[model samples]
Target: MNETTTIFGIRAVIEAIQNQKTIDKIYIQKGLSGHLFMELQQHLSGGEYNMSYVPVEKLNRLVKGNHQGVVAKISPVAFADLEEVVTASLEKDTKPLFLLLDQIDDVRNFGAIIRTAECCGVDGIVIQKKGGAPVTADTVKTSAGAIFKIPLIKVDHIKDAIYYMQASGIKVFAATEKTEDLLYSKDLNQPLALVMGNEGKGISPSVLKIVDEKAKLPILGTISSLNVSVACGAFLYEVVRQRL
Candidate 1:
């Protein structure tokens, strides 16, 4: 974990709770129960902490401190709720410019993409909960804290996210060299989502099927493709250009 919080005794745990730190989970030593335990249990049950009981061995592995049977894992950053982000954008009466990254696993690429997206005034970024590169320490630092400013949502599947966007009247445009359809042919001024794929596989076939348009960057270079972030910039700039 990038960040951690340790509360040795029950009182410390209560203090942490009182301080309003978001706990990822909590570990209580095995065969533990008492008034203090009850207090801990009550506090945890009503709160967001994932609670569990573990042996002393696990607690020892966690730290060398004299933990009085409690350890809490702290999340580094708060997550962006998709509904709040989407609804707020709609409420603003502005076009929703969402960027959906399909399996872009490199941390550097992820950060660079975020940097570009934020620079282009993108409303939000969406990545799959599993396959995509998570916002790690590297991603955070690479983005230069822009990750904190822009909304990032992790979804189960890109296709499902796409479907929801379409239902909400957002058009999804897949930017890839595989498509002969030039980006300039389409109207990007509408509420739009740009899908940028992985470094190796590009967007999955499942995701591509649902895209409203497969728009390609006009490539006259000898190289076959542009980096995911570079192509993302191209697609995003086109949107900005059309909107302006």
Candidate 2:
């Protein structure tokens, strides 16, 4: 990890949170408790931030300086607002195409998805603030700079994003092997948001329940499933083909 990528010390971390810095996660020394820790906890109670308690040795390994029992990994890119993105797309008389990722924790997979989405002219990518992968140097490198080119919105929950999209007149689709609906059968030329799930678990049940449609790519090979990034690329390009 880059030194600039993390915020060390309790006061620094607390200040970063208060300043609305995009924090990926925070690491605190185990058994740590004090007035400062309590203050930090109070500030963190407002947003969806991942916090982990680890040994002091782990903190030491992350930084050479005094961490004050706390370290915060910062997001490489700032998040975009979903409403703004949608409104802008509508104002321009363009049918919006958004990608919602649920619990996509692999940095490289997330990066590759972003690259594909950008190429497909996706208006924005929606991700849960806690479960999704952090935008790090590795993600940037894997994206081939597409991370910087695309708009990303981090929501408190994936279901909330689905609800918001539906309210904004965007049809939401869940891509999963659990569904028998074929991807090509759906009309993708309308305002739409496609939900891609985690590598292992697929889309969450709550998210799948609320989506307007559920579709899957047909599997002809003996393999049980496709990699999340490859599946995402196939889905996105299908949308591109339909639009053209």
Candidate 3:
């Protein structure tokens, strides 16, 4: 963890949260309680932040200063509003291409996907706020700074985002190995969002049910599935190819 990525001390953390700073998660010492902690808890009741209780020793290792039993990991990139992004993209009179990530927890994989999305002229990338990987320094490094170039929107849920996109007339395709629909068989030259799922479990059934289509890349080898980032690249480039 980078020291610059964290805000230590109770008052500082409270101020960061109150100021609406993008925070990935906050760590508080177990059994901590006080007027200040109570204030923090009250702010957190809004349910926008993620909190974890850890031992004081763990907090100590995270920071050298007096953390006052609280430490917050700040998100490296500011998240964009999905509705605003979609609206703006449509208003520009260009076909919007989006990548919706479901529970992509690996920072490296997330970075790789962002890199590919930016290179392939994707309009933006959407991810669930809670389950997706936090944009950290490692992510920026792995993305080779593409994280800053690409627009990233964090939503409350992937399924809700899918429905919102569909309502906006954006076709959503879920990339999965279980589907018989081949990726190349689809019409990618349109306003669309591609949904890529978890590295292990794949797209949740609920999300898959709502997607306009489920497309899979061909796997001629013994391996049944490609890595999430690799599959994402294939699908994105296919969209680029179709657009051309």
Candidate 4:
């Protein structure tokens, strides 16, 4: 995997943004103000940016060169188009399975889930543009290069993706404990999209209301919960098992 690219200096960051680079995050020095910085702000206006205001020491730690109080991390891979991926998958003869991640915040968990999805023959994985883990060097390493093998699509909202899936005639299911239905009971051999939620919150209430069905893993052990990535693997493999 290629190392995460860092663009520093106000002018350099502006150029990268203007070029439509997939920026993971941007760090700026607190109380920063200058002509060049103003230009960068103009470029950043009216957009969803994962920006943070930190001390110059933080900026220095982010990069070795003079950052001009600005540092931006660029994604190594281009994000896939949701419509294109969904449409293409529907055209295939085999049943298509898609994975929807609702604000998965851990990079390692995200990477592991990607690997699992690829292994299970998922058509693609959809993630929201914000309020989720940023793609970084750790994410790339944890996926073990499976990140490159799968189609990773981003959307402004998870619910929007859910709506699209429903309209396209794909069954949407949420992996949550709220339902009495065990995962094994569900008829999984169909075109489906599985929704997995944030680690601490589970699936959002708004999301839970819309999914066609909800299923849970039988937890016989004392612990009531499982890691999001592990749970995702179990849910995905059930789909694989049913189809075979």
The reply for model 3, stretches above 4 Å from the true place, is: 1-4, 55-58
lDDT (CA) per prediction? 0.80, 0.89, 0.88, 0.92
Candidate 3, 6-96: lDDT as tens digits? 8898889878877888898788899999998899888888866667789999999988988999999898778898889899889876799
Cα lDDT of model 4 by residue, 1-244, tens digit: 3658988999988888888998888999999998888888999995778888999999888899888899999987789999999999999998989999999999999999998998999999999987888888888888888889899988999999999999998999999999899999999999899999999998899999999999999999999999999999999999999999
Which candidate do you rate higher for TM-score, 1 or 2? 2
Compose the digit string of candidate 1's lDDT tens values, residues 1-244: 3433455667887877878865545778999878987987887777444566899888888778877788765545666777677777777666999999998989888988888889888889988755667555677778777777788876667887788888888889998776779999999988888999999899898888889999898778799899887888888998999999
Which candidate ranks first by lDDT, i.e. highest? 4
Rank by TM-score (best first): 4, 2, 3, 1
Measured against the true structure, the TM-scores of the candidates, in listed sequence, are 0.71, 0.94, 0.92, 0.94
Task: List residue ranges in candidate 4 displaced over 4 A.
Answer: none
Candidate 4 overall lDDT versus native: 0.92
Better candidate number, 3 or 4, judged by lDDT:
4
lDDT of model 3 at position 38: 96
Higher-ranked by TM-score: 2 or 4: 4
| Rank order (by lDDT, best first) | 4, 2, 3, 1
